[model samples]
Target chain A: MGEFELIRRYFASAACAAGAEGVALGIGDDCALLAPAPGEQLAVSTDTLVAGVHFPEVCDPFLLGQRALAVSASDLAAMGATPLAFTLALTLPTADAAWLEGFARGLNRMAHNCGLALVGGDTTRGPLSMTVTVFGRVPAGQALTRAGAQVGDLLCVGGVVGEAGGALELVLGRQQVAAEIAEPLLARYWSPQPQLAFGQALRGKATAALDVSDGLLADCGHISRASGVALVIESERLPASAALETLLGAERALQQKLGAGDDYVLAFTLPPRHLAELQAQWPQMAVVGRAEAGEGVRVLDARGQDITPRQGGYLHFME
Target chain B: MGEFELIRRYFASAACAAGAEGVALGIGDDCALLAPAPGEQLAVSTDTLVAGVHFPEVCDPFLLGQRALAVSASDLAAMGATPLAFTLALTLPTADAAWLEGFARGLNRMAHNCGLALVGGDTTRGPLSMTVTVFGRVPAGQALTRAGAQVGDLLCVGGVVGEAGGALELVLGRQQVAAEIAEPLLARYWSPQPQLAFGQALRGKATAALDVSDGLLADCGHISRASGVALVIESERLPASAALETLLGAERALQQKLGAGDDYVLAFTLPPRHLAELQAQWPQMAVVGRAEAGEGVRVLDARGQDITPRQGGYLHFME
Candidate 1:
């Protein structure tokens, strides 16, 4: 069969490709038409994942599919937008039918979870990689950006961090552990649930927000630079999953929580007045830091001394 | 320097990256915010071009950048949507400053010409490839689609069809010709102008439309299938550029016009009553044939004899 037929069979027939709200037209067209509700602005983000670079070259297609969409959707969550539609540009080395089937199933499952419709995409023959461009809708002036944090706001994280970072060892076959410790970490790495609902809940409350993909200290620096305020992290307050702690012990887990990347948990700045009410609703939410009247990011140990790492997190293409 | 700095220097500082009318927030954010006109629907399309598969691996980066954006922007033209903003997910083998500089210049030039702002995108290290997701806006219910052709509507193409196809020989260094004959053909291959204005003019007039990427015959088959009608093409009506004819001669040029792809020209079905007026506005618009009450696509000779090829255009993965 032709690639066109392959795409139609694997993707066009997926459940999320069916007509959905906000999508006036979906697949099988030159362009997909989306009508955002009146007074809402469209939120758009694009992310590309390459084999070996972003994920294991030889890995489960189903997991790869899930991780790809989740990583892109996390951006919309950071913006406090309602998920609407997405386009996937997939490049594969070959047309492996079994792999495509598994991938599509996982992709559709995540699409359902994220409330995103598969509006359009292009499939081509090349290196194994995919670019997912996600679209969402937010009220005209209510999108949560990294540029709104104030000096006196408390810096917080929505969920556990560093589990995905610890899972990388098992994914690369460099380490092995019992399934009890491994499963949760791997699941966090593969199927991270973008904190969509919590981000929406933060629209009027959070001063600034972003999904953590580049470690706690590094991502907090983005908020600092964008909002023109400094961020101070209390190292003892960093949240690390039990799976991560079990896999790497407390000291290494603390290091991962501070410097490892790829955790999709949201990190945001919130005024002190709104903290109590929000914490009541979101129990996992932890206050780890605070914004300061300065520039750059700093980390503090329990002894009240600065312990910031010289280099915070991973930087792609840094020689 | 880091990848983030590379992106900021090469892309975020481009002329098109500055604040634009429709874009509320651009680069440096998790997601860009775009506000369309109140009654407009967003037209979104994504296209990926892999190195060596889509273009010569050692070709000019500047031309590659121009071709990539033009290829994606053509879909918006096909839908008669006004160009607004685009995100480019570019994966490169390395951060080659010289190549990136040239590529950015070319990309910025096309973005300016097409009136598209540089929105949010991700730059990563991987095999050389790029996926461009473009967003445009058109009045609700007025965007042209492939599902609206009537039985008697005339089949039309906006511009010259075959120069890019003929240029493939030169691109691959398989053919040698005079500079005069080669320049225009190569230009078409590297930077085929999308018929944006012509497509906008066709709004409310053309019944169905799409850009010619897959060969004319194959793309027409799409409209035929979608609209549930047969498209009959008069063989002699296929538009071949003078340069293409000069390079490949009449018969070969005709073949290229019918069977070769990557034209980026607008193909649409229009009622006869609107043809004269549209043709007057768009001098290059040519009426090639008519839709019939049937299925599939056919090509007929001037003698009215059925002469359709057994296979139409290129299909990506057909062994």
Candidate 2:
């Protein structure tokens, strides 16, 4: 079969095997038609993960596929949009059937997890890379953004941070730990969960929000700049998994928590009262910091001493 | 500057320079939020053009930008969707300032031309490629689809065909022609206009439709397979421009008309009554054939003898 036929049969049609909601038409048309309910908005995001650059060239295809969809879908989570569908633009050096099947399986799994139906996409021959454009539906005026934070808002994370960064150090051989400590960390790096439900629950509660793909400090900086407020993160309150602490000791683990990337946890700003109310339902949302009437990010030790690092995130080109 | 910063400056923010409506939040957010008006469904399509496969590696960046967006937008046109917004995923091998400027200009100009606002996108470093995902609004259940064509419907093309195919010959140094012949053909190839207005006009009229990127004969085959009907085209009814004829003899031009790709015209099915009515409004829609009871596509000579060709469309991987 031709590559187009291969993609149509295995990838495109398989994406809809379990059926999809909000799609008027899917898979077999020039364009997929999506019917979001009246008074709802569509949340869209695109992310490209290049082989060798974004991940190791020899990584498992299944994990790669899962990571790719997860990365893009996290944007919808950040926006408090419920996943509707996604389009995959895949560039491959060759149509390796085994790799394609593994990738398809991985994509299928992730799509099911995130409720993203494969709507439409294009496949081309080139270096191996995948670009996923995700679409979600959010009620009008209810989507979260980084520009809505205000002074006196509690800066909270949906869950623990920096496990992915810790995983990266192990995977790249920059550091090592026992298999027990490494397993969960690697899982966090390879298949980070997008906090879709928490984001939806935040709807009108969180003043501003974003998924923490960059380190916690760096992503909070985005909230700071966009919302025109300062974020003061309390060092003692930084959420770290026991695995991270056991793997790297407290100080180094704290560095990973502060400066490393790809956590996919949500860092959000909300009034203290709202945080208290939401924390009652979602106990994992820890208040690590607060938004203030200033600019940029400031870190304070347990005693409120200045402890901000020079660099807060990864920049691919600059690196 | 880092890759993200550079993209924020040149590509991402530039997407919103003209201000896109229906987009509640655009660049600099995790996801772009778009609000389609009530009763409208979102039409989404994605197309990727890879260097050395879809286009030459050293082509003009500006024209490449225009061509890339035009190609994907054609799908929306085929679906009779009104242009809404688009996201770009650009992967490049380097960060040349001039090339980026030229590309952004081309993208800006084409987005304006097609009325597609750039809402969000990503920029990555890799082997050069571009993926554009476009969104448009079509009233629920009113979209034109390949499965909607019925037997006895008149098959019409939005405009002339084969110009881009002829131009590709000169572009790849496979052929040469006079400046006059090359000018129009090259323009057609470099910046083919998506028939957005014509498509919107055909809404509630055309039974089925698709953009003719893979040559008219090939795209018609798609409608045939999809609609469970046959498409019969008369050789004499094929539309070829004077430039196409001048570039190649009438016989060669006719072959290109049937076999070559990238015309970006619309081939649609319209009932005789609707055909007549739409013709009164859009004279450029030339009736070249009709749908009949069968499967696949058939071509006939002016005298009505079967002249079915061996190949239908250009498949990138197969080729």
The sequence of per-residue lDDT tens digits that candidate 2 reaches over residues B1-319 is 6655776666653466324667677777889888888899899999999999889988899999899999989999999999988989899888888999888888878888998888888888889999999999998878999988888999999988888998999888898778988889999998999999999998998999999978888889889988999999887898758999887889888888887778788999999888667888888879999999989899999899998889867875674
TM-score of 1: 0.98
RMSD to native for every prediction?
A: 1.3, 1.9
| Model 2 lDDT tens row, A43-115 | 9999999987888888888888889999998989899999999989999898888998889888878888988
lDDT of 1 by residue, B156-180 (tens): 9998897898999999999999999
TM-score to true structure, per model: 0.98, 0.96
Q: Which stretches of candidate 1 lie over 4 Å from their true place?
A: A13-18, B13-18
Candidate 2 docking: what grade? medium
**Model 1, C-alpha of B51: deviation from truth (Å):** 0.9
Q: What lDDT score belongs to each candidate, Candidate 1 first?
A: 0.89, 0.86
Which of the CAPRI classes, incorrect, acceptable, medium or high, describes model 1? high
How would you encode candidate 1's per-residue C-alpha lDDT over A168-220 as one tens digit per residue? 99899899999999999899999999999999999999999999988887899
